[model samples]
Target: MTGTDTDAAALFASARERLVDAPRERLGDLQEGRRFLGIPRAARIVPRGTAWHLGVLLLTDDAVLATGDIVRSRAEVRRGFAAESQRRRAELAAAAARGGVPEGATVHLGWHPIDLSALDAASRPLALREGDALVRWSAAGGWMPLARYLDERVELLRHPPERA
Candidate 1:
């Protein structure tokens, strides 16, 4: 693999390891009560045709590497109206019923890698331009370098603040 490819792969691996190592409660917090990673703990969605394109900022390099999926809105709605809490679960189940993917799918069944740069406005906040470093955003932290963001998140996951 080329140097850039190797670096990107390493980045993905390290991030995955850190995420896996985080305490279940912390990971759960990050996932915000979601049942599957494929459902994205956080994401930006855009509607296109019959599907809603789903994306989450998982990692980054030259381009923002994301876990992406396409959910058929019709199918998901057909399953029944989901309250805000159960939306993701309903989408995942509906997607599975439709074979978990459309023909010529760019994203596979699992939350595989996808270039967020290829997406439209949804990618703006996470885009890594030429000669630019990667970053992530949170309401409290705003924009932070990707490496720093990962480290901080993992550290917080390992040591959460005690609740009152």
Candidate 2:
């Protein structure tokens, strides 16, 4: 969405080579300490608690990527956002099942898209327009919506300003 020149096709190809067939050590470095890292096609969200957290969110701005697991395109970004919203709807149901989001509880959900052109090419934290923060990230897995997981905390990380 930002004005930048990134060859999506080349970026995609590079991502595939580095991530789709990466070795474990390379994957570890990316996950543990770098903005860009290689990951395998088998990436997934490992359940850590009663709820779900995409292990890759740590390195990403948002929690969904179009690695071979899902179609990647402007359409996919839109669809992924929809899917993430739906996932939150499901989480809401789950929370309601468990007595619902507390009157004053909070959770943090994160995701990242590898091809976003607005982020800094230098691999550091970048600011999204409306005071939102952006970061580079990649990992093996599908996406997740955690609004219910965040409850009222969603205000803390406001979504990027709506387009004109």
Worst 10 residues of 1 by lDDT: 23-32
TM-score of 1: 0.37
Candidate 2 lDDT score relative to the true structure: 0.28
Error of 1 at 145 (Å): 1.6
lDDT of 1 by residue, 4-115 (tens): 4345446556765655544321000111234475664422222221211112353322223343433332244554554864776555534433432332233322233444
lDDT of each residue in 45-146, candidate 2, tens digit only: 222112122223221222223212211111112224367766544443333223322322322223234434544433232223333334222433322222
Top candidate, metric lDDT: 1
TM-score of each: 0.37, 0.20
Compared with the true structure, all predictions reach lDDT values of: 0.40, 0.28
